[model samples]
Target: MTTFVSIGSLTGSIHPSLSGVLTKRKTVLNCPIHGDYEAEGIYLGSILKTQTKCPQCEEDQREAREAVEAVMRQEAIKKEVEERVAKSRVPLEYRTKSFDSFRVLNAEQGKALELSKRFVRGWEKAKAGGYGLLFLGSCGTGKTHLACSIVAALIANHQFLFPKYYRTSEIFSAVRKSYVPGSQTSEDEVLNYFSGIELLVIDEVGVQKGSDAERRILFSILDTRMTSNKPTILLSNLSAEGLCSLLGDRLYDRVRSKCVPALFVGQSMRKPATPDLFD
Candidate 1:
């Protein structure tokens, strides 16, 4: 059982069996809100020092510490995501694009916005199914805008998704550079890097010369990604037929199998700045 004992002006409770070995004391202390309470004091070899901590106060301190730790953990995750975004190589101009900032000037733009948001909302399902999107239309039609928005949303919300954004020309350029004499990188290395990304967005698809070499380079990356069930986004100014010719029958079939077309039709959002001659 338990027994309560008084040591000078303090009171403490201990089991009778521990009376000889353990020295425990308690002092009557007044808490601002809890009123009078007994503060437990323990004596080792030195004089006993009373710790005036109320039970309720300790609980409050514990909760505060937990809240601080939670905030710190959130900050760490945010930092990690930011670093990954930096390494993603998103173009500086499109880095700030998001669904909220996309302009909805026409019915098609509105539909495109809704589709992009749904894609982000169903990211897990899309990733599992190897589904992707094709942003097709004329240049300045906000194709790249929506593409970057999708990538930005995924990176911000899904920490596990690693996304890469590059122009079709950039990929071709990288592959060509890899062939230079004494080049540190190889063509296979370049293709493998593009193929291994969880999500890849290739912009300006039809800008490159339709050389057989370019076609082969594009085909190799797409084929590998398709086989691995990785999702891809292609931003292009070509019509459906035009893009089909560029990708050829076999490669186009693979893209159509997993990618949904988000047609962005309308005037280019870019407007030339009028000159202020008088100024």
Candidate 2:
């Protein structure tokens, strides 16, 4: 036979199968915030102990813990992106540039901004097709600003992407230095480094003297990138006709085949909006 006894808010049971072992009780426990709830209490001899918790409060606490963990994960990702951007070799002046920071003064600038964003959004497809961008216009037209913005966006979105930024003059300078006697680096080493980058941005494209040797060096680097199905961004102040003349037909055609031109037009951003006091 089984026996039951009521004590305070607890109802306890003693079963014949466990006569001298222990007893079980159903007890009502009060929660300050959630009011009273029923819980199971265990008895060893005369001592009764209950494991009590408010189900709703436990659920809320669990959700809060998950929310905190989620925020920490996001912060970690942001920090990683900042570290990678710092190491990406983007110039100090342009490292902080982003699509949101780009100022669109006119419709053309607005179109340019949108195009840059679309390129980032479709980067996987662009990378697969070896497609890139050509930022053209006169100086101070935000060409480099938009280019760096693209690089920054890519770095943030793609964990493993390798991006490099260099001026047209720097490329020639590096290769020229490699030709010096007793130089540790070779010409092929310099060329191969530029060629192997996952994404390459060459700024000031038409700044170099249009010599046959310069053209050859540029051709070798661009041709290798094309063959590897890698993309290259070209930033130049030269008009389309002038750029075509500088690059000559062969290299110009190679660039046109894979690049979507975003022509930025307007006065120089470096120019002040208001008239100078002396003017």
Candidate 3:
């Protein structure tokens, strides 16, 4: 038999009554959701406030991760662009010059091209030194053209060649600039830069009057690069003996010992406004 209890029978005692239906009116101390209901976790009830993560919080976390990834990608691209800019030093005059500019009218010109192609193909390995090139020849004979061509190939195809070009005058000027008041660059800084690059092209080795001071500067650059096992490409418009005299005995010995010799002898490829068609 089921016993039925009423308010008149048990006013101040426990009674058999159904659970009350919860409503929004009793949710004064309710959680953010499921008002006046039960929940799971510490202080488990919907009436008390909880510290659970909100939808907005989760979205924020995901956005933060994406932002970090974006920053990393930007930094990587920035580094690559900086490296490319540093490698590009070809003058506007020679910017468009390529292997196609040369006619290879003689064995020496062809040989220079073959060596350059090999260097470009093998640069990843050759950049660590042991093999370097010395392009000793007259101006307009395509020495600079061949050297610049290598730069073009690497820029177009290779990754991180980091080639640098400097006329012998510009090189010494950098060192001289350090002595000027308020200059940011130092001599050692310039030296470190030239010595540490992947491949350095020093052009016009004896373009002007060769003084003992100039020879000393050249000696320091060459000697440091040699010691560090960095390959260098040298361009000049002088004969071997003349260049040796300009470099002096000690520096020439160091240069000749490490570099493969190539003599570029040909009619000047430069078209006088009328062009030099004579071989």
Best by lDDT: 2
Score residue 179 of candidate 3 by CA lDDT: 83
Please give the ranking of all candidate structures by lDDT, highest first, separated by commas: 2, 1, 3
For candidate 2, write residues 11-43 as lDDT tens digits.
Answer: 247564434435566667778998887766666
Query: Taking the candidates one at a time, how many backbone clashes does each contain?
Result: 0, 0, 2
Residue 36 in candidate 2, Cα distance off native in Å? 2.5
lDDT of 1 by residue, 127-187 (tens): 8988889888887888888888888788889767789999998999999999999999899
State the weakest 10-residue window (summed lDDT) of model 1: 2-11
TM-score list, all predictions: 0.78, 0.82, 0.65
Stretches of candidate 2 above 4 Å error? 1-26, 41-50, 271-279
What C-alpha lDDT does candidate 2 achieve relative to the native structure?
0.85
Report the number of the highest-TM-score candidate: 2
* Per-residue accuracy of model 3 over 102-199 as CA lDDT, tens digit each: 67889988998898888888877776565578999877888888888887777766665568888999988888898899999888898888788777
* Candidate 1 residue-wise lDDT at 169: 89
Collision pairs in model 3: 271-275, 272-275
Task: Report the C-alpha displacement of residue 57, candidate 3, in angstroms.
Answer: 45
